[model samples]
Target: MPSRTLSAMDDHDPLTKAISPPPDETAAEKEARVKSELEAKRVSDAIDDDIDKQRIAEKRGPKPVRVLLLGQSESGKSTTLKNFQLMQDAKAFRKERSSWRALIQLNLVRSIHIILDAIARDYYPSSRPLMKDPNSSSTSPSVSPPSHAMPLPKETYLDPELLELRLRLDPLWKVQEQLARRLMIHESQWKEGLHGGREVVVNSAVAWKDVFTKKMANKRESSDSGRINWDDPTDPGRVLHECAEDMKRLWKHPLVQNLLEKQNLRLEEMAGFFLDEIDEITSEYYIPTNDHILKARLKTLGVSEHRVELNAGGGLGRDWRIYDVGGHRSLVTTWVPYFDNVDAIIFLAPISAFDQVLEEAPKVNRLEDSVMLWSSIVSNKLLERTDIILFLNKCDIMKTKLSSGIRLKDYVVSYGNRPNDFDSAASYLKKKFAGIMKEDSPLPRTFYCHLTTVTDTLSTQKVITSIKDMLMRDNLKHSTLLL
Candidate 1:
């Protein structure tokens, strides 16, 4: 007990003895130990989460592959889509139905409805024009339905005024939505989706083809029944009277007038929304930094069409944001930006158009001139290296004409002077592209041209597969080890 130094206490061992932990610890000590263990466990858990996130990022693989289809109006851009992307065969459609790609497309279709309806309003006046007379004949030409045939109308063609209205009002959204819904129905009803509890139903196996045929038959029957013999003018005034009433109602529709005021705005909104949805789909499915392939319609949006990533896909399948631009000359200007990042450009021209093109050759010179003219416009601006695929669309028609030696021009006045020979048409194309071909040995990796059609399913498959194979080759540079 004399002044004990710490060292001296060590020697005595009293301090150690007093503080020594017992074999059986107290509850307080146990609680502290448990707390320390829990803290360490939490740190470990956080590290695990971080590692998991990293693994997920790496596992998603590279960016998606994109394919762009660009061509003139009536170049069979839509037909190419029918042949390539659309699930034509039972197997492909079934496979795609369960895929995120199908979902993305469905979403695109759904968005179109909203956009088009907004546009339709613009064609009709916010308020109906005053009638010539309260008691005027209902048959007045102005009393016709809006651009589209009113659902209840018994006429085959919409009234001329209404048709003009549709032309004035952009109902592209509506038309697009209607088509999309039809496709959706085809998928759900003809393919897969739950009917009850079990997933045993094989929609493709059902007789959906017959259902369509029956519908056509019914339509024909109705058409025959509703036939109006214009030769007989016994009821001329009757048709006129009904139209006047419709015009009165249409003019009075507040909804129709409201739409007219907003039509231009609606189109702007549609284009914006379509682009946004495309981006959303792409961001969701496609990997970052990679481009997507587009086979877009050129009729409504034209070439200045924007693309957006719709979603991501697993290995082997890549997600895309695609726009089918209008094929008409008016919208071709818009196709420029789309060509920049485009990996491949499909020049769609109807096989049937070959003769007509040849007939006009004296004016345009070479088939290559026509193609080169288009190619030059888009190719000159491309930042990303690109390849081209020339689609001889409507090959079914071409093949039929080719095989039968029938001049399609006989039936189609637009074909110009009927060509006596197919060789002239073929020779015309070869000569036109000859200069460009000579400039690029064998074929330029920068471009590829093919004569194809979506209606001819086999040819379409070959064309798309070949284009995708080329794209995969490009991707191979970024993914050589994986391959």
Candidate 2:
């Protein structure tokens, strides 16, 4: 008991005795103890592995906030989708640029068809009775709606040189027909979110059969050419050259202008299919520019979802999905599936449509339809909490349409003739839309809006950036996945 070591003293401690190793025993007993210790370690490691897996699963698959592009047909929703591609998925946009060549050609051909239709309508009237104006109270079958009728342009005719030129370029029309039929087939076969048919056409489609084919060259340089030249000097260049003079003449002719005026058609927005640039647009190796693609209108058939992993600013590596749907009334029924988890909705209202009629419903004024549609969306219980961003799109077109004497008061009675300018008309539309938004939403929903010509990428990009910033702030405010 003179100087006891610490171990010797601890040997007598109750706690030490409780945790002490077992006394030396038989070999079988030692082996059994070893087995039990190994088994415990194995069980502990398995628990750790399960915990690591749970953490990895949580970090791996973060849900993407859905954003929907919503509007009536021709309201610029798809164009906005293309802009997102251009901004977020530029490589993809460039990859698809060649494919868009066929679409641009189709748009030009569509203009030609529109002119032809106008000419036919003027000379050869339809047997089916024309629809009466919904605003009018007249019951007489013979009563005409001259007020709504598009203004007639100066007279034009198929003269000698024009007729000869038209005959020369007749094959182009056939190619146009082929493109149209392909689009019809593709669209008819499409359902919601499945664009396999679109890709099918993209794979097999040519700009214009017999007129041109893909000429091997640096794609960037090929896309910028403003001449009737191809890297591969094929036959189409000669065709465009032969009719270049006549093409210019055809575009400027009062007759064509008359047709455009009569039909209230603006082919310029569709790649601005200028007759002066016939040589360029109809080139054998034509590649559509971004602006051209912006102007390119492909009638949407179903919902197209584009997933963009934003570079920075917006939680890097985070998924920003932009959706574009066929804004037509019939296709709207497909929009319900998307409503379940939407974080935002970019609603496009073509302010220019104030005096126009819905393509689906001929008698319904476009603005009225837009208001009703807006009311339905903003008031929808399903979407009450979703961020609703209004884009009064086509401000450019609205300006031109207003300048052309398309009166807002004529279509929207509430407009009341308080200056038929862009500001007044746009303000009127904004008020109409704002009235529909739910003021009492529990989420403190804020209304974000912009007057946009989405085709103008410069301005639209600014708006997009603002939206991106706002979204980041909102996420931080609510502590939603903001890195």
lDDT of each: 0.40, 0.61
Residue 391 miss distance in model 2 (angstroms):
0.5
What is candidate 1's CA lDDT for residue 259?
53
Q: TM-score for model 1?
A: 0.38
How would you encode candidate 2's per-residue C-alpha lDDT over 1-483 as one tens digit per residue?
A: 599556754537878777666787678988888899899999999999999985685578775657888888778886787777667655544544544665666555445444544444564454111223365344322121211132223363445554554555455543543444433333222122110011112211222222222332233224333222345333333444455565566677787687677766665543234444566677656767788777776554666667777666432456667777674675674575556477788888887777677765778987778777777777677776678889998899889888878788887787785898899888777776776674534445677889999989888877877777777787423326454
- Using TM-score as the measure, the top candidate is 2
lDDT per residue for candidate 1 within 338-359, as digits (tens), equals 4566545566655464433322
Off by over 4 Å in 1: 1-60, 87-299, 302-316, 354-373, 399-424, 427-431, 437-447, 473-483
RMSD of each: 21.6, 20.4
TM-score of each: 0.38, 0.68
Q: Score residue 410 of candidate 2 by CA lDDT.
A: 81
